[model samples]
Each structure stands twice: as C-alpha cells, then as structure tokens.
Target: MQSPPLIIGTRGSPLALYQANLVQRLICEVSGRTEQEVIIKVLQTTGDQIKGELKYFGGKGLFTRELELALLDGRIDVAVHSMKDVPTVGHEDLVIRAILPRADVRDAFISVKYDSIDALPEGALIGSASLRRRAQLSVLRPDLTFCLLRGNVGTRLRKLEDGVCDATMLACAGLRRLEQENRITQAVEVDMMLPAPAQGAIGVEVKRDREDLTEILAPLNDRATEWAITAERAFLRALDGNCRTPIAALATLDGDVLTLRGEILAKDGSLRVAQTVSGQVSKTLDAYDLGFKMGEAVRDEVGGRITFDD
Candidate 1:
C-alpha cells in the first residue's frame, strides 16, 4: 500500500520555513520519499499575531499551541519547532521524536554603531524580549536600558538597522539558519550570557500515535544533543520556569560525563542563584537526574527570595 504524503507543520517565518525545509529534506532522505511526497504547512500562531510585548500577551506556548492543535487533529503529520519556543511542559500525547544536532548555543549581539557589547556606551538603549537575556545583560551593565523588541530574526535586524534601539540580541543559531550570520557583531560567550535551556536545538514533534513517522525520524536524532537537552530541560521543568521567570541553563557532554549549570535571577538582575552539577551518564536518564537535583538545589538556595507569580 502507498503511504500518504507527509505534511510538516511549521510557523511561516523565514527561519521557521528554513528549519521545516531542512527537516523535510532529511525525512525524505530517510524515508525514501520524493520531494513531491512531502508537504509544508505554514500555520499562524498567536505569537505571530501579537505586536505588543509577548509577556503582556499569552506567553508560554504562544508560538506552538496552534500547530500542536493541527497535529492533534491530524492536519499535519509532524511539527517542526525551535526547541526554545516550546514550553517546558510536555504534551501528554505528543513526543519530540528527534532533535537535530545543536547549533552555536550563544547569543549574538548586533549593533550597527557598536562593534561589540563592550563598545556600547553606558545608558545606551538595548532591545530584547528574553527576560533571561535582560537579566544577565543588566547585571553586566546596569547603566543600560532596554526596549521590547520582538519578531523573527529578519524583522529584528531590520528594526535595529532602522534605529529601533542602540543594539539588540539574537540567537546565533537563528541567524545561521536564516543565512544572516554576517549580521552578528559579536557572538557573546556562554560565560558572559548563559543561554536558555535547549536554546540552539531544533525539535521534531510528532503525535505518539504515528509510530511509522517516529521510526523514520529516529535516525535523525543526535544522541549527544538529545541528552544535553534532556539535562537542560529537566532543570527547567524542575524550576517550573515560565516567561515571567528569568531562568537559564546549559548542559555540555564529554565522553560519558554530562555537566549542567543552571541559574535563576531576579528580574532586575539584583539577585542570582546558580548551581552546577556533573555526573557519569552511562544512560540518558542520568542527565535528567543530575539536572533535577541541580534545579532543586538552586531553588532551595533562593527560597522566598524572588517568585515569578503565575
């Protein structure tokens, strides 16, 4: 029997389309399906509709729920997502079947007038929608002020060029995927600015009922990146992090060892709680355990210090 064409769901942004096309090519290669056998479904999400600050609108799942609904209704066979946009909570019936290899897991500082973060003058205006970035950058340069800049990679850069702010921050991975890496003035080091959990990863989500598709995507999974994200996300899940909270985590693997570092900061960047945990992970589950423990420790250390109200 001939299998039906595979429909891939994704946001309509340039970066989203690029990611979807990449996944489409990979799926076709693995499943021996021709280009015509695959379809790309561009779906508009709430996040795309909101021109105001994301925090004011529905935050978590803002960019994902519509596509997820499409998946639930079988409108699409699979959904391709930027893992960072995905909420920390898991969907009961959906599973991330594959995660592409990690990208440059660092923030890119883009400024037309300044060469780098250090070059920016005090009191200069900066733009970002990520609370994590604002908190970390505020701590580094308390004199700077911020304006809300929210959009896809191209839009943000265009705004920067039009003098939206003195500078802006973006993920290096997004620029690379969009073929706009040349716009990055400086790739901020992880030490200077810790990235969000699973920041640079691309996750392929599928309804659990689709076993055949799962099998096809299994070969695309990068075990190392998967475990690394597992650790990072486990830390996020343990903290119950949301857009309101400023939380950041990163995990790195070397041989059989996994190390996770997590941070929770006050909105104003006044107080920060950070912790690091490392363990020998002969199995992937070990990374999850390590991250959970680290998260718990950080939470305990900052008890009642700052709370992100629901």
Candidate 2:
C-alpha cells in the first residue's frame, strides 16, 4: 500500500553495488513491483575507507557498522553484507534476514607473471591484507614477502600489474561476478589454503521482528550454504577469530554430510594446525565443535606465543 516501504542500504563499492542490484532485482520480481519502486542507499563504512591493513580495526562488522546502525535507527529497511565480516552470536540490534546462495569458496591468485602461488619465484612479493593469507603464504613459501595491501578488487589487481606486487590474493567469486574470471591464473584450491568463513557468500541484514521483510527474504536463502556457514562461523567464533589473527575455515557438502576443514597459523606463519570433520546437517553444532577443537589443538601446538598483532 505504501510502495512496500523498502529501502536497501549497502556499501558503495563495485562489488557491493553488484550484490545490491541483484537483491533489488529479485525483490522487485517477487513483490510484483518495478525497479523504481525499490530504493537503493549507499553508505561508506569505516572498513571501506581505511587504506591500511584490516588488522588495525576490531574485526567483524568493520565494513557494516554504518549499515547496522541504519537498520537499528530505521533509516533503512535492510542491509546487504558480505557475511565473513559478521560476528557470530554477537551484534546486538541487526539480524541476518537471509544468506543468499554461496559462491565459489576459494581464493584466486591473479598475476600476469605467475600461474599459481607456488609458481612464483623466491622473494616474490605477495599482496594481501588478510592475516590468514599472509601466514599461510609464509608457511608454504617462506621466501615470499607479504606487505599490507588494501583496495577494491580492480584496484588491487591494477596494483599487481603496476609492479606493487608480484601477485595478489582475492576472492574468486568477486572476480567472476565482475566477469573478470580470466584474470585468475590459478584458483587456490581449498586443500591448499582454506578460505575464510562465509567467503564468497552474500547476506541480507534486516531488523529483527520485521516479519514482512523476513518473509520476503526467505526465498533467497540457501539451506546447504546456511548449514555450511553454521559450522564455519561457529568455529570462527569459538576460536575468537579476527582479522588480527590468522585463521581460515571452509565447509563443503557431500549429500547430507558436511565436511568442514579449518586451519590456524601463528603471526609469523611458522606454527600451523589443520584438521577436518564430517557430520549431518542436523549435527551442525557438533561439526562446529570439531573445528574449534582443532583450533585449540593448534594453539597448543604453537604455545601461547602465537602473536596476534596488537
């Protein structure tokens, strides 16, 4: 009656715009409305404007703080987010209304000179801001050097070709969404480097108690992806994982059994721990416990000196 009174807020980035447009299109279709009937709002977040290593910020919701407040204040009807930046069992006011279908859950190595991470020569410079990527890179190729690099997908790849770095790590899904998949010389397989929890997934956030919005968003939810993240995020939350710490997790579905693989590395990337678990979807919490147990085991393997940068 009031034109659905829907306003979708998202970060102002190429990828964010793309994801928001998608949700906008779907909402328009389902609600029997036109694109003009929906409103799109862009907000700049602390995580988006920051130019240095993300470790400096208190991890989780670094990119969605503004939008979260918007939801709380009813300035916007809903928010779109990349779920990896979200906290599990945390965040007071906003609620994740739906987790859209997941994407390719692997990191892609884009370089004009190299085909894969191992293919790069010794002393090669790898550009990435994620502690998990840095630690794992160090373990696999101790000769490689990691410098703090932050920017949008296009900006990072441009820097790589501009000689700022020999190679850069990015979400494979992001590249593909922008129709630049050919730039991916090699996609880091899950076995080689576990991806972040909720990587390559898009999530819709809305205020709790908004049943009308929830009903509208429920159609986009993917049950398998939802369950997979249930295990992944649970593990991350249990380990107190954050950007300052090097932690990676991934989950896959094989029929009704979900397999979760997780890894944790010390700051220098010297100490590492890895493990895997399989369980039913209904046993999601049990699977999550297995991952946290593995992380705890890793911490024991590394001792308490695993330096998570201050």
lDDT, candidate 1, 55-88, per-residue tens: 6776769999999999999999999999988987
Q: How much does candidate 1 score in TM-score?
A: 0.97
lDDT of each: 0.91, 0.82
In candidate 2, what residue range of length 10 has the lowest lDDT sum? 281-290
Q: Model 1: runs farther than 4 Å from truth?
A: none
Give lDDT tens digits, candidate 2, residues 109-184: 8889988887899899988888888888888888898877788888898888899988989999999988989998
RMSD of 2: 2.0
Measured over all alpha carbons after superposition, the RMSD of each candidate to the real structure, in angstroms, is 1.2, 2.0
Which candidate number has the best lDDT? 1
TM for every model, in the order presented, reads 0.97, 0.93
